[model samples]
Target: MNKLFKLVRHLTMSLFAMATLIGTTANAERLLTENFEYELGNLYSQGGWLKYGTQAAGPVQVTNNALTYPDYQDKAVGKAVHLTQVASGEDLMRAVSETAISSGKVYLSALVKVNAVADDQYFLAFIQPTSAGIVDKKTPPENTRLIASKGSVDGKFVFKISRNSATLFESTEEFELGKTYLVVMSYEFKEGTKNDVVQLWVNPAVASTEPKPNAAINSATHTGADMKSFQAIELRQGSSATKVGPEVIVDAIRVGTAWTDLFDVASTEPTMTVTPTVVYDGSAVAIGSSTTFATYAVEYANLENPIDVYLTGANRNQFEVSAETIPAGSGKATITLTYKPQAIGKHTARINFESTVSTLNTGFAATGIAWDPENPPMIVAHSEGLTPFTCKAGEQQKQTITVTTSDLPDYGKAAVKGLSNGAFIISTATLLKNGNTQINITFKPLVPGDYEEVIEFSGIKATTETIRITGTATENGTTEDREGDRLPLDDSKP
Candidate 1:
């Protein structure tokens, strides 16, 4: 009887221990782990990832290289994805979770190597899932955005974080190119509206069970709309205006509910190698007219067969490409793009050269603007060719320049050239249609000497005009403002 009782107790204890282990494993499982273990090619339609936004934006490609870091569980496991700002590279998104994560904090970790940095732009973000189908090309509510920008020191780059679409919180230290770093980001969903917070860590120790108390960057103040939930993670290449890093490679992307879920285990996961696409900005043309705005020559090498070309975009109808197909050869062909705008505004589209050999396929961007001929956009400076002013050293003198515009409203941007000593200050102004605006120009000289500045005013689709400002600064001279005679109207194309 004693032996029987002991056996039963041991069996019960063993079952309980097994159940506990099972529960812990389920809780620690990662929501998503992607190492790009697939064949080298386009990232689209691979491993459940889909392309979002304008098709003109080329697809992100999987490269042959792998990124690794010390103590990273999935270090150097599979291939990596390359994102480039060259010619508006593609944007991709994959569902991290089937259901939206609303309450608990979500954490993401990745290995990133920035090859180059340009203008500030977000390269990675989280988006809410949609039952209506794949998320629209129009950007959704971005929760935790990872941004990149030029560093304070040359030849280096920095990482930044943004909650929703709010201002970016940048890292204090600049990161170098060709060096891989482990980046971790977490988003906490607060109970109230607009109270959520985000934190970013660079080179955090993977073995640590919890995130560091002091993150490299944090956004305590929330801006933009509170994300109800997030289900997908997006890789953004950004546009020409909001250009991202020139070349950025990412690998070992893991998403989880807890920090331990990301580092405590190892998992296996899942490329195109495409050349950089071309981007062309066409000059503004008048409405109701068609113009061959730009032309590009696409070269096909090691061609297996003939390739077909296709254009895709909302404004694709407004643009026409000359070549529908390219003959199989190792030669170059010139492709002409014509833009005809039925309505006035800016139009953009993409021309893709498609072929069975994916590497041989290439594309170019086509962009043009259409404006009304009668009321063409124009801004004129109604001032003298050379305005002379007299001021004393350490004294500031102010002058006003009258700016008139045609029937179209224009935003005038003022730039002072040939002076970098803070001697001249110019204000930007918006000129209403068929109206006039006054732009204030201030001249303050520190040392008594002669100063000259050429102020240039530039507007969209408008001809640029320049005004030469000459000033004489003396130790005891009284401030004097003199306006020069108005010049004749000059018409020129922008």
Candidate 2:
């Protein structure tokens, strides 16, 4: 009797362990995978994707311009979807195999490369389906939105997250344009109402078992109805006027319940090697001045297989490359870059090298700044002088002008001239400080007529600056109309 009881206990434990293994495997199932492998054309009606939005706006296109990132599971798979925001554009959606995912957490991952982004808008999202497997256009989906906008730094952009229509939670780290990044979003469906959570991870480590998020949004504070289930994943090309969505290339979209399901365990080696992954021209040149030429070497394992090189970014026009195509015979080639900035701001761009024989791709960042130390101060008039400042006769109107200078220990003076009529009274001359200074200009016109004057600022370290001020004295009550225009401060003069 004792032997029989022990055998039964062992068999029961074995069956329980097998059931647990099966359940764990089932939880890691991938529901959707889209590499956009199809003929180069419209993405609608291809590979079970359907078109929505305004038909006249046209559908997103599938291009052979595929993108690859380091360690991405679906590196350089078939093709990619090109989404460009027009005046109005059509959006596409593909229904997932498991339409009703009510419980557990859902993970969405994609490899995205932004070419251009004008304003803050969402480019990708997911929506719940109706009984007939159709998305409800009237209701906003509990989505994993990828929002892009101009970064605080010039010539850079940042990504943000928005769950449903909640406020956006943006990332502080700025990203370079024309670079591929792996983005992962997870949506957690709580048991209660209005308690769903969404989190976003940008460029997370694929090899890590648990990856943390860069930004997140919760439905409790943002206030969005809890989603019952998610049916389809969408690529939105929002209207240029309102949405102003970004122009981006999207690839390697995967939807799963676990993080490991979205990434592959095996890794491939890079075909080509690039020296100095980040090419930074740290020299601060004056506006319109050119920086010293710099070169980046691209060496390939196979000499016969060449690579194509290109530049893309907001400040890409400021840079010039020596060669576009690296020759096949040469095992390595040098590409020179020259930075000649026209504007007085930070300039940045990216240089992408794509291999001809393999899916291996890499890029380097280039950055520079243009500044004028001699003429670092800026003068701005806060009056309605773009058209004319208007005031009634026998009334005094005051306008404030601010002079902002860089943190340089330079002292200067300013004076007003071209005041023919005694109607205009100017403030006393004072020495300019290194920081901001406020100057007052009072217009007390006794007669009802038009008047003009000029404020000349001199004795500064750089060139002499001037501001043109005009005013109109009306017979009726005073009125302040039109916004003031800033005079172009010449930064060329030493």
Candidate 3:
């Protein structure tokens, strides 16, 4: 009975250990992954990707048609984030995640393809965030705790971990130019000095049946502010000289608790579908004038085998096609189409969608209005002079001039001049009941002199009118002197 009891106890202990191992393996989770499989042309950010770069650095290009890396040549793995400086060596390009991480021993990995590597070129593949919003490389925030960077320094590839403006760890491994490499970084957050740890693995063999980091090229533990969490990350690249313009392509980026999840690839071909057949409003557009239509969206099914959706239309120049490529796992994408009337008469175009398996021909119609500036309405004066042309100089005098036209005012401006020491005001410049535009001009004289003014009426595409005015200002009363002595205006007194 004692031997049987011992055997039972041994079996129970073995079973418990196996269960614990299995549970540990199942607990691993992926925190974030960005494959760049979607076509986000001209978009600054999507799916929480916020691009950051040096003051004049070009934005990162998210594309899926790169053939530089043959290993990821297919669309499934072909999509990548292309980063390059704008011919300025001092420029940096980076795309940071909107999500923030505060705690955990997180693993970050990505497949990076260096199209051209030059001397003194630095590329920071993963950045541990310290604060929210945008993280600028030129002036990193004070809370910035750590950064993992690699580059070709002194004609050799080097990996480094930096903390609080200090280099914590660096690797001596060398990398080749125009080559694809898998990089993995593990960051363990802890409180107090010498408690936080960071490790890096280059060309990690995570895709193999037995997945693991190739080898730890660099590792370090440093003391700083309590290492609590990271708010964002970025893939940054820059150079030290204006002549060295290097381009880096990255794909299959993953952040998780373990390195195994970084190998996740698209497994199926998505089904494509567009809904409701976008139809722009059928309206008349004026020639040399533009109108914008409402925005619309396109929907598709997520698939493993990536497909390209091309939006083409007849008379492409007249219409602007703005759309983002449907990502590998996204079910919907929005497209904004704008049409500008180029010529007069009816304009018809077919906006067609071409995909791997289907095509949608969207019919659009618009009418263009012919606008001739030379035929625009003209402005004419009701009469030549003011109603009352004469006024007393010493006593303020007023006159009314009625101007009529059949055109809209040109920026609400009617130039009036030749009123010397006199004031003029337009009480009204509006259309009358008979379809004619009437402008009421009032002029007041202040000093005795021949007052004259030219009023011009102008409008868009309309022949304007220029009118001349004549006015006289006389003394309010006359004083006469018989023998060097002035007399009052009353003739009797004189």
Q: Could you give candidate 3's per-residue lDDT for residues 292-404 as a string of tens digits?
A: 55344555554433434333334445556565344655567765566665543344444444333322223333222223343344556666555546767655545555555
Candidate 3's C-alpha runs over 4 A off are 1-26, 53-56, 65-75, 87-99, 118-121, 125-156, 207-228, 239-246, 264-494
Worst 10 residues of 3 by lDDT: 140-149
lDDT, candidate 3, at 343: 44
lDDT at position 418, candidate 3 = 44
For all candidates in order, the CA lDDT equals 0.72, 0.72, 0.51
**Where in model 2 is the C-alpha error above 4 Å?**
1-26, 73-75, 135-142, 168-172, 266-494
Give model 2 RMSD, 1 decimal.
32.5
Per-residue CA lDDT of candidate 1, range 331-410, in tens?
Answer: 67777777877755667788777655443346767777766877767778877643577788888888888887663423
**TM-score of candidate 1 versus the correct structure, residues matched by position:** 0.47
Best by TM-score: 2
* Residue 165 displacement (Å), model 1: 1.8
Cand. 3 TM to true fold: 0.40
Query: What TM-score, over all chains together, does every model reach?
Result: 0.47, 0.48, 0.40
Ranking by lDDT: 1, 2, 3
